[model samples]
Target: MRLPRPGEPRRQFVKRFLLLAAYSRVLTADWNGTLLAEIKPPKRPTFGMMRLRLSDFPALQNDFGSVRIGTSALTANNPLGLLYPILINRATQGQFYALLSECTHAGCAVRPYSKESGACVCPCHGSRYAIDGRRTAGPAFFPLLQYPIQFDGINTLSIELPDLPHEIEGSLVRTLPGAEFRLQLRFLAFAHLEYEVVFRASKTDDWRNVQFSLTPEAPLNRSFVSGADDYLNLYVEPAAGLGFFAVTIRILPV
Candidate 1:
């Protein structure tokens, strides 16, 4: 048998091996890192939104107080689930008008319009939207956005909404009641102190020395104070009927 030439170098042999791999569709590329990873889609189907106007509503011939205008999408996502309530107003003797379906604050669901208030009030967050979904009161800063609306030649109407306004117009908050009296308590943690709590019930300084024991229920006073005020480490006690007390505490700085 004839011997093959030894002139080919080891690098040339490696190059030939790579060429064979390429021809066989084998992968040999470096994998320092990847730019993108695989991703999965949401499980449920996302339906498009629809809208309608007053003229188009009559064509549907929906019963009064028995129709929901904004929840047809729910039928697609959740068959058995009921759509949210959309309060429609009576434009004429028998016709209906679509109103803002969601509340302005926190985007929580809104209840039926209160004829007395002339606004669609949210039972949750206490946001009130007008018949046009305008923000009337509560924490919402913006009005309810309407859906795309269309009308048929007849009274039938079609409405589509892309994404309902889920964002809140503003934060939810309430006014806090002002305290009748400002008391100060200054004393050691475990020391016994004479204290009497009273409620003036009015702005006057007249105090009622209420009698009570701290073992069962510690009481607060309408006037005077006794609590460590972050500085000055000190303590003070008062008489049993001490209607109100003012004690200064001394705290040694570390």
Candidate 2:
């Protein structure tokens, strides 16, 4: 161990102090393989998560091809989307990499730069990363987070996700105006929350003011009646041109 020399610059002294602290932590901890300067805590439930299937991605069907954006439904409510986005790249046959779309620097969604380069570029601040999640350019120091992926050695694939409550997702196809849409939302037995499920006539349209509230008395199963109004009934066409609607769940603080 060596002491800092006298009359060190303030910035240099601060950097040296941080380096020593990190080194001390490394020394005290078990070294499995790779070392990290800082370890981020495990992701929480509110963060976006995905469960991707490999065959569903066309780019991965071939070897060493372009990156593809895969989306899967989130288990719970998140501002991002009902479907969580992930980046996938195939290195070779049966070898693939799955990375979160969020940039490590400013948390912007990273977009594919070029198929030949196998890199993702952040639009917010010019952060660049390889398909394997390593930071490749300036403006970002930490590597993008990677998730575990498993394949059945066939068409099916499963990606590990953060622990989230089981969600009722997808749509119900009905032809009747008074068709009832039912959703069964279950949370952790020990958890408590205020929730609302809102419906909208279209994917891009605003949700109707009629919203369902979760209550302690009967929070397990909830139902919504569609086409009860003239405005909604107008969308319930026989051709099914504009009848598509959406139900979104919003979790509120207790």
Candidate 3:
């Protein structure tokens, strides 16, 4: 499949890419706040990702219909920390639902709404989601983004995620209480290209840019800190040639 050339606007690139992916449709947003397209999953959906070991979570063991929230265990030093306060629930024997604990409507973190109902409800607006992250109620019309799961018969449960963003806007980004942070970049090798990691402490903060080139000698990864809030954006320079990359960012606790 073809990818957007380097330097293309991120939203535009994602739009075109989503069109090309109509057959394997990835949910995305348009400016008017509408779904670009929808496709049925051919089977249980899955993606490549950093694995989180379930063995580390004893609270989830053998507890059917149980829901709990915890960090993805990705610290400032762990690129996979991009996903945090992950919601894990045991639906049945050998079955689990692991999803990002963020509201699909306004980027607010959601919490367990009701154990009996098996939903994660957003505190800001009352968007309710099922254990599988299906939006059972609105304010949030879209379902929650979930991580792929791989359970080893005995003691290891691995949460799988793509190196890329699940949804362009912060769907894969996690906000932790902190002033320090890090971002790891994994892109298709394009030695001549330069990329920028832009960010702000909050909605009102000015954007800051951290630029770097992708070279064979070493990868472009960075650590950052902001005294106010946490947020980020990625951009590719030269915008004309074919290029692709995935990044994971994590905030260090203060």
Give the number of the best model, judged by TM-score. Answer: 2
* Order of the predicted models by lDDT, top scorer first: 3, 2, 1
Query: CA lDDT of each candidate?
Result: 0.33, 0.40, 0.42
- What is the lDDT for 202 in model 2? 59
Better of 1 and 3 by TM-score: 3
The true-versus-predicted C-alpha distance at residue 81 of model 1, in Å, is 8.2
- lDDT string, candidate 3, 1-254, tens digits: 12343344434432111100100011222111111111122233444333334544444565433333332322222212333445666666687777776678987666633455557777778888887788998788899888777667676555554332233321111122442121223332211112234433443444455553323223234332221112334322322333233222222221
Rank candidates, TM-score, best first. Answer: 2, 3, 1
Candidate 1 structure quality by residue, lDDT tens digits, 1-254: 01112233323211000000000000222111100101122122332333333333332243232123331222222212123434454433444455544555554556544445776667667788765567888998887665444446455444343322111011111122442221122222212111223323343354344332222123432232232212222111223332322221111110
TM-score of each: 0.31, 0.43, 0.40
- The C-alpha local distance difference test score for the whole of candidate 1 amounts to 0.33
True-structure RMSD for candidate 3: 16.4
Candidate 1 global TM-score: 0.31
| C-alpha lDDT of candidate 3 relative to the true structure | 0.42
Candidate 2 lDDT by residue in tens digits, 1-254: 01123243323311100000000012224111111111122256443233344444455566554343322222222213332345665666577666776777867667643455557777778888876778999698898788786666777545554432232222222333555332222221211211233344454565443333243223334343322112111111111234222222222210
Shift of residue 145 alpha carbon in model 1, Å: 1.9
